[model samples]
Target: MRMLHHGQASAQVDLAWFFRVAPAKRGAPVLVVCGSLLVSHTAKPPARKETKLTAGHRVAPRKVAGDLLVSGKAYANPAEYGHSRAVRVAVELGKWRKELAVFGDRVWLPGLTGSSPSEPLPFTTIPITYDRAFGGERFAWNPEGMGTGPGERGVRLPNIEYVERRITSPSSMPGPAGFGPIDPQWRPRADMRGSYDAKWLAQNWPGMPDDMDPGYWNEAPRDQQFLDGFRGDEAITIRNMHAVHKNFEMRLPGLTCRAFVKKTDGQLIELSMMLDTVAVDMEAEHTELVWRGATAAATPKLRDMEFLFTMLEPAGALTPPTGCYAIFEALRRKTYPTPEEYADDTKQAAKVRAAKAAEQQAATDKVVAEALTYRDTQMAQARARLSSYKHPSVPANAETGRHFSGIAGTIGPGIPEFGADIQAEMAQNWKMFAELFPSDDENCTWTRERVMKTHADGGDMSGANLSGLDLSALDLTGAKLAGANLSGVNFTDTWLQKAALSKANLSDTICKNTLFSSAVMEHAIFKKAVLTGAHFNRTQISGADFSELDLTGLNFEQCAGAQVNFSSAMLKHANFRNCVLPNADFYKAKVAGILFDDAVLNKASFNDAIGPGASFIRASAENLRARGADFRNAKFTEITALRCNVSQSQFDGADFSRAILTRANFSECKLKRSNFDRASLESADLSEAVLLEATATNVKFLRASFEWADLTGTDMSGSNLHEAGFFRTALKETKFVGCILTGTTLAL
Candidate 1:
């Protein structure tokens, strides 16, 4: 009585009513119901068989499996009894569970699934908490069994035990009747449970191919319309529900669909996706894809519903539902971030920009310093050259004429504003030269007293017309008469020392016994002027024109007269000792007895000048042109005439002892009794020249030419005649002892 009768049924139920309804057959309802029942239990129904259930009520096979998994009951199936529901639910669960067990204890491989070898373990563990599964039930916590011992690396793990315990519902309520017994030892084992290892999942899940369409999910027309019309404030968030198992998320906020997949080892692996405005969740293996502008009201359909959703593999395996492939594609190109790591990256970029800015500033500062130094150095050099001018003393035997009687310590007018007065005076002077000033008679009524008054009042009187003026015996020392018209003027015994007469017109002027020492007479015109016994010592007469002038006995010693013109001038007995006359023109001038000792006449033109007994002792005359000049008995002792042209000159009894006359031309010249002892005459030309009784001891005649030349009674001892040419020349009584005649071309 206590145990046998299971008990009278508490409620009488219609078994067929709980089952799926079947469509009525054409003949009767009995056969239709029988056929529907058979179709439900069988694996395949006949292809031509008519089912009582219409398409609307029918469920797909995989969909039934999913529903069973979610609800733990196959309500959509034809099975009505409790035993059938339980058996169907258990079977579907076991099937899925068995597929996921392959990755239970497997480790992940690197590069194959975007998992790096440096990443920690894929499986994680947590303490089995009662709140998660057992609702405040006391339980033993074996920390060593839960991976808390020395065998485990400290990492956050998924609550695997709690999930399994909750999902399995292993124990039923304990009652008097032993319907189901509670067993603590009957726990889920690794062989029977599903595994969701994060690394394993990430390694097995499929990703977008390199050639797939990137805009499949994001750029469709319907998706664009939905996105464009959306205006929501609540941020849309997504999460990978089974990312630890399949490397995939089930629900993505902005995308239409997502999926999870089982690996060969039965582990769920996560896969990548692409979507617009997607932000990655970098906290763990399983995380959500967050975005903006998504609505939760209606289910989002795929942008392109016509194309079947599929996950494609390299081997062409198609996993269905590929609508949200853009999201995974975009994620593949992205780098995940946590808030703290992002902040660190931003700080690092700021530091790098600051460093570059500092470097550029340092470079700019260096350039500015260098520029300032260069400017300061150049200013110092200019100041030195400007202050080199020395003021001359007034001589006693001179005129007492006064015009600001003290010597000027500096050059030029002091007040720059007074330059206008000088310009106006020049204008009047020019008008006077054009026969327009002072009633067109070319007359200047300015007096020395008036000029002195003007000078005292700081008025400039430069470039004034003082021509034909009787300025003799006047003490005009250190006066600023620069650019003045002093043509035909008389300056006998004038104390005009240290005067600035630069660019002045002194043509036909009488300057006998005048003291012009330490003066700046640059570019002064002395054409046809008489300068007999005039003193020009230590003067700056550069670019002066002394052409056709009577400059006899004119002493220009120690003067700087570069680029001066002495062409066609009468310079007999002129002493230019220690003069610097670079680029000076002495063409066709009568310069007999002119002394140029220690002078620098570089690049000077002395072409066709008549100068007998001209002394160039210890002088530098590089690149000088003295063509057709008559320089008989010229003293060239220790002179340097490099590349000089003294062709067609009379050099009888002239001495070139210890001279450096390399590349000099003595062509068609008379060189009788000339001494060339210790001279360097490399590449010299002596063609059609006379060299009777000449001494050439220790001379270097390398590449020298003596074609058609007379060399009677010449002593050529200790000479180097390498590459010398002597075609058809007279060499009577000529000595060639100790001479190096290599490559010499002499007439046989």
Candidate 2:
């Protein structure tokens, strides 16, 4: 669960719930004369795409630079980002500048052509929209078809290419979102469907060694016990999550409890797990009283419940436990009987059933005697015999035309039309009466609340042709929405916790801060969608297509994201720490200062990512495709940049402290002032490295390539430079502090 240097992970996605909602009420039809799966349904209106550079098909060299899409206020449609124009955006950071090159309708980011200029680099994200109408999903939502939003069709995203240029100033829009002064809307829903439940605890916690055995008592620390059970791995997530106020126990029969969870390794930890049985709770009046005859009547009335709570909590870091007494009050059944009382009632029920059975048997005997008297005189009619057996076998069914074993068999020749039918009716009546007053059989079953499954939408959409619906802030909490064509739906601020959104066409959807916690968002697309603060926490987001989307300022710290397509994404200042991002595409992405600490990003791609001064601290980036990354002065402390394809990267003034660069390919990269202190670069390919004024204290460069490297004014104190190639390299003013140089080639 560590970060990779410049790679993404690959893992299979598990299926969760998918939900959908109806279209929006307001807004004129903005989509004109087109059939797009990613288009929304609205009242008929003029059609003019507000985004910049829409393409009719998946264009070649996917990321064109000149005209990047601009995000602004929400206009007429929720799916649209207003004021999008094809303008060349240039960023100037400190002493670097990166400019977008434009050509007609085809716009391109700085590094779209897989080429980097030999200059100081500035960070920038250039968004491009598709022209073709978007298609529908699981097949349509893969890495092969990345960056293609709702307006475009059949677009393919390629591996990233970072633009290497000079920056003069940071090109970030600062401050809070323009929707007024920022305040977290604490919407504590009283409805249980969007809340918490015990089932979540049972499913998530299970009987792991970290479970707490808090027995039922008058006073027991339930909430404390719950927290104690998940103090290890899961507790880390809770510590970093959004805190909330809630009761610890079941307030109703069916309730769903939800608390914001913190991400761990780019994924939700086991601690943020929850039960989803009672998603919503109803009033007490909804639970009706039942009378099992007059002798047994039960009502769910509230009574005062006082339980003593005890918990095992640490007094301090290493202090003695301080056991204290506290009172907890609860509302429970007013007159609920214990097990002993219920058993006594069961005995009474048995007596009543036995008396009724006796009365029915006597009546059956009298009828049989009367029928036998006229049997011989009525032309040899079969005498009707009343069954008086106790505890009969299973009753046979006439429906299947088959006789089953261990069941009662009926014996007869043919039809006895009129009188026999009448007798059969009477026998059925007698059976019903006997069942109502059974003979000494009393069974108690736990009463469960019946869940209502209803939704509000016009016309059954299960098989309807629908598109272009604005489903912003939709409340389909537990609805099943798998395989639905969600081409043009706007799911802004929607609550999809534990819901399924798998294989849905979410192209061009605005999913800002949308809650998909534990939802199945696998293989979903967000091309051209503004997913700034969306929470896919702990959900299966593997294989999701996020290419060509506005993923700027997105914080995906510590989450599972294997094989997620982020090719050509504008991921500036995005935090992707400790994530599982292996085998994902980051082809030509404008990713500056994107955190990737403690993540498993093996086999991920960053072909030409423009990551200037980005952090790779404590990351493990194996087999990464970082062709021309601008790692100038980027922090890479204690990182495992092993076997990566970092060719011609700008590593000037980059920090590589305590890093493990085993067999890493850093051919032709800038290495001026780039610290390799305490670094293990054994057998690493650093051939043709521009190592001017480099520092290499305690660095193990055994069998490494320094061929033709300019190591002028460099220090290698206390370093192991054994079997290193300094062939045709400059070594002016270099210091070798306490270093070993066995068989090191110093050829001119």
Candidate 3:
């Protein structure tokens, strides 16, 4: 009432002329728009609902856990990010996650997701920080979490997380939204959003079975992707102008019409598409689906209009590369700026050189310090083991705890490039590694003399901690390198004959055609390391560790080791068939057909070991003490053992003909297809053992004990028996074909 009618009408009079135009109905004029509309609408994306006309791909779903462990879990579609999230997630979810009963099956859970309680049990606050919704830095990136640490208990975890659940879908089919953009439910908040599929959305929002539910939001996978962008405590949000529906077109980079789409219907839709943004199936390392949702409101025209870009998730922040080597490379390029104080003409080149020298010295000192600290830690552990020396007949020599040297194979011609005239890049890398682990440089150096001498002659240094170093083609024949850190080093064409490298850290190292024959390398760590074409033949390396190392095409024929550790090491094409490896450990080692026939592996262990850890057996170990091992297809001929111990071993397809077992113990072992013809068993203990297809002829039996043993398909032909007792031994299909009977006794 206070305002005049004419003035009130002026306020309402036209600014509405700028209104956005809509498609004309019955050839009518479009509506006018006004206000804060940033961008104009684009064209409506075409729909290609080829769900019924698509094909399927055979894929396995894998559960990831531990360090780089992939569960062979296939998927209907493949996704990949090189070795970034895929590898990391694969390792964590499969091996370290949980037991079969813990998960509902098939929903590939990440490390940060709620874990099942089976093997790697899941908890509420697992201390992990994935999925971007971290409660903060509660969980650190620890490969050996809890008991998996180096100093922790030796509890070997099963790497493959066998996910039992299958991909399940809802009973009813989900229909598309009529003519509008995706509802708020389909495109929910970043932290509280479900998948693009309506079925998954239903799981998040219960009320909207058919209609769009505003409550729909992210669960685990989406939340993780969202957080990967924002990072830390920064708040981020993605806005879209229109609702999501089938009527809009999405435009994504790095994709084309030939690109196949993985639909929720478990098929690969061959129909071409145009999408804005896409959901990345990180595991398969591919863009699985093409999103479509952004219609063009045509005001009776369809020319060059505006584009309404729809962001899929919160904006992400780039994380810096944390790899030490990457940082070192950057610094090597002089990318690290110098100090501001050194900007004067008086302090020009000369001062720069001085500063560089100082920095180099500091780096060297730091590396030395770190090595010393590691040494101190090792000494502490050795001290703990030293207490056993008090026991008589067990001095527990420090050298015994470590393998120092072995009979190296003959040195071949010196490598061509090993001589001083190598590439500058190679030289710098070598120097860098030597600096990181200066202990390897006990007397080695890359100074004027060393470098110049290398140029004149051949460069060689084995049994050294060239970790984080670049040492390509260094002549290290007959070098002594026990317990060295060689991680991330290069040893292309390195000569390491008979080099003692026991208990050494060789993780992520490259050693192509490196000579390791007759080298004593007990208890060596080779995790993610490559030793292709390495020679370990006839090497006496007792108590060595070869875990997680690639030994593909390596020749270990006739290699000998006592109490060796080959857990998680790849032995593909390795010729260890007839090697002497008594008292060895093959816990989870990978092996292939190469050899192991008629060698010695007595008292060996293969406990908790599996394939990729497999091997062709062909060997025998006499007078050894091995517990828990697999020797499938091993051979034994004329093997005599006195006071031998073979417990908890697998000897499938082993032939033990003409062997002696005097005071020997074969307890808790598996022997299948073993031929023990003409073998002597005097005071032998076959307690709690499993033997199959063994031929025993002319065997001496003097106080032999077969207690609690399983003997299936044994042929005892022409065997001399005296004081042989079969107590608590199960004999199935046993044959004494033409065997002598003296003082052989059996008890039920």
Q: What are the per-residue Cα lDDT tens digits for candidate 1 across 531-621?
A: 7788998999999988888888888999997889889988888889999999999999999999999999999998989888899999999
**How many backbone clashes can be found in candidate 2?**
100
lDDT of 3 by residue, 648-711 (tens): 6776666656666667776666776666666666777666667766655567656766654676
Q: What is the TM-score of each candidate against the true structure?
A: 0.40, 0.39, 0.34
Worst-scoring 10-residue span by lDDT in model 2: 288-297
Q: Between 1 and 2, whose lDDT is larger?
A: 1
Best by lDDT: 1
* Candidate 3 to truth, TM: 0.34
Off by over 4 Å in 2: 1-466, 746-748
Per-residue lDDT over 363-415 for candidate 2, one digit per residue giving the tens place of the 0 to 100 score: 99988877876666563433333334344445434444354432434544445
Error of 1 at 463 (Å): 2.0
Residue 553 accuracy (lDDT) in model 1: 80
